[model samples]
Target: MGLFNRIKEPIFLKESSNAEIQIEKLKALKPLLNPEGQNIIEQDIKHLEYGIVGEKNIAFELKNSHMTMYILHDVYLEDGDISAQIDYLVFTKKICFVIECKNLYGDIEINSAGDFIRTTDFRGRKKKEGIYSPLTQNQRHLELMKKLKVDNKNNILTKFVVGKYFEDNYKSVVVLANPKTILNAKFAKKEVKEKVIRADQLVKYIKNMYEQSKEIGVSDERLLEWAQSFLELQKEMLKDYTDKYEQYKIYKDKAVKSIQKIIPTVEDKKATTIIVKLPVEETEIFKELKAYRLNKSREENIKPYFIYNDKQLKDLISKMPRNNDELQAVAGFGELKINKYGNDILKIMSKY
Candidate 1:
């Protein structure tokens, strides 16, 4: 949901008024309250208090003082559908910024390709697993904002991963359990500047956006439609996995793995696509991937066909071979592997 949706609506708007009554009814009902979700909401509420420190009027006047932020939670912009109900939509006179919040835990790394990987310490044994990258979703949100033709001045739309337990390995605009540690690290590394917004500032910015969106007569019709469509798509996507814990876990992990995994620009320019089958013993797939490339000449297709282990399948999707010549250049490409995995390799290409 966008940031502005969280605030109480203008008591006058007919739709908003009815929505408010429904929300109140839900609150009054006993079975509907989600205990765990409520706890997180409480924490977020507390953090928000600290995030917005300055007065509304003064914040607007100061340059770099108040960044109008619209708070959106669990928003999904899928197939042109907007995901969450907007928390609020903030429109500063100049630019509109959207803040999408995901309440999560652990340390995360978002690669240049926009893949999200989270690191966890389970019983002190560290492990890493891929998850949905917020960067990809944020970009989709930006596209929605553009479709909405929100004031063009809002050039920067950023995503935040908030939780009490994220490791501060890298400096970012992350809200963690230790605000002082984050600040100190920023200053000590001389990397501490304006990139990070304090919690109070975050709240103030969101509030500012909410008020401004109201003044600008922002409409949520399109956004709501987008939200409903996104929800449906999510259900469809999740249907492939079985409900069994072990069975579904693999799908869950892979579904997250696909997030931000494919970059269309890189795939578009490929002149060749090669499909290869790797030897079973080798450890590093990319090394073998590179070796396959070294032996091939430039005249061939830019795409590579790989019939390697199941582990290497996802990587190949992003590196799809452009043509038959490139497909033949892969590590274990032969008449046998080609005939056996040919259709499978073509299937991967079709996805992009």
Candidate 2:
């Protein structure tokens, strides 16, 4: 039965993604936002689109692999307060694979200590930065799956055996979905190298793992049943994709109101005049800020506006946020941006 199943082509049990919906929602909200807010929303949409394309690349490979497997895309699982949004789950006759898809934009290097560093080159300059480990992320997803499986067993013996079986049969893989990313894993541990691979290498990697497994293969029916058991654990996420943009709109509105109070508009019968003035020293700070933005944008190989547009840059200079908490109070500096560039921004402001 197992041999017969192994000859069949792979099938996807779940493939639809909510990212498309989120993108559409963002597009609808973009026009309603101010110029600065619109820029930030556009960046969010592009990031989500890249993620969708990466997942689709992986999907295309799985559909064409001709191996016997059941695949699930975008499986959201929750166990009490702990939740995981897994990119893919593949069930073969002998093993279940938990995959984490990364559609990164730069060359990646894995050190002997298991740190993942990303390097991006723009023109002649190259910048290196540490990125979160997809391998570690996938391991957490696998751990959740293992705990759920073990807890489902009726007896202590069955629970222990299930836990042990899971450790042996379940595998975690980090697939780099971007075709152009160069992965340097030679310095990494053997275990780390084994867990990460390019999108094109995924099918071959799965086949190798399947062939090496000592567990007996099951029939297509049993394989589907096993896959279904895990599928049943998937929880429908009720996330409001527009929440952040809505908050941005509120912040923009408040900012506009605050500015209106500071610089009142005067109306006359034939003419209306509004006077605006800024400190002379702000000119130097603006130059420093723009230069910093340009350098950072080049290093990341992204548009300068993606970091912060002229309006947001002026806002930053006006607020002169001293720390992460103060930076968050500014309209465009979210947690991600704060964590990535906050300290550098503060240091520059400190000099002034």
Candidate 3:
């Protein structure tokens, strides 16, 4: 009948092309979303699955103090984070769990390296990237729970990687069937626990943890402040990367421009024009550019601009042979860079 009903009885729900199309549309909109936007949309999907599939009862626990919640969440100790903030916390009598909500799509694969990959269909092409390592992040949450001194040992403390429900999309929550699946995948486990549960059973523990934490103590403003700081730190770390990227771009442009003037070019400008991508994140491209520039006989006629990643390369690929603005986008190709190596890049490109 409906999507929710279909989950309860997958056979009867009737998979339609319309549902699949709707899910694809949602995926398209994911990138435009902010963190909060992304999180909410994901939660909506999970609830839809629960409604349709008759999921296990998930008890989440968080205190709404002054319209804010301070949640003791599952975390990874290796990443060294305190706890994650959660919205829904249900406390039931039997089981306990700290729910960590993730809005994701595709089958997740955990390998021997202790790394995780999320499978996504990018333009109908399957692509995977290393994402939130549940083992690492959740363990940190466990440690934080212990630090909080909650009587949770008597209760079950489990972590879940909830997959967001996309209408007609095959988004399934996959947890390693057992702890052995992870450890024998050859990664060391910080703690030895019995079997790891997935699907409905994980929800049961979440409900239990929520209920148990409620009896311990309600989270206070101090806890909220601490969570805020942690989130901020994550943002700050991201900002640092962005700033470095920007700096590299600015300097790279200047280097290219300076090279254009100094490097002697052939009369056939069109044939001489070529674009070479610079390496990013400690790759060989940086060294190659430097070495080539050093040995050039007519180094004055060459200009070189730096490029970091494929995305950066894609942007400049269209504007080959260096424009002022495009050159600016290259990191480390600053005015001094232009004065020194701009002609060198031009000379190299001219050879092509």
How far off is residue 236 in model 2, in Å? 1.4
In candidate 2, stretches whose alpha carbon ends up further than 4 angstroms from where it belongs are 1-7, 238-241, 250-352
Per-residue lDDT over 183-241 for candidate 2, one digit per residue giving the tens place of the 0 to 100 score: 99999999999999999999999999999999999977888888888777775442334
Q: Sort the predicted structures by lDDT, highest score first.
A: 2, 1, 3
TM-score of 2: 0.69
lDDT of each: 0.36, 0.80, 0.35
In model 2, the clashing pairs are none
Where is model 2 poorest over a 10-residue stretch in terms of lDDT? 253-262
lDDT of 1 at 119: 75
1-352 in candidate 1: lDDT tens per residue?
Answer: 5434632332111112112322333333323324654444345434443323222222232223333222222222222223322222333332334443333345655444445566778999988888764434544555553443332234534222212111221112322222232222222222222222433455454444345442333245543433333233221111101112222121223222222223335656745534333332332434444455434323354343223433334334323555655455332334555666566556545554
- The candidate, 1 or 3, that scores higher on lDDT is 1
Among these predicted structures, which one has the highest lDDT? 2
Over 324-346, each residue of candidate 3 has an lDDT whose tens digit, in order, gives 44454343333444555566555
Highest TM-score: which candidate?
2
Give candidate 1 regions above 4 Å deviation: 1-84, 150-352
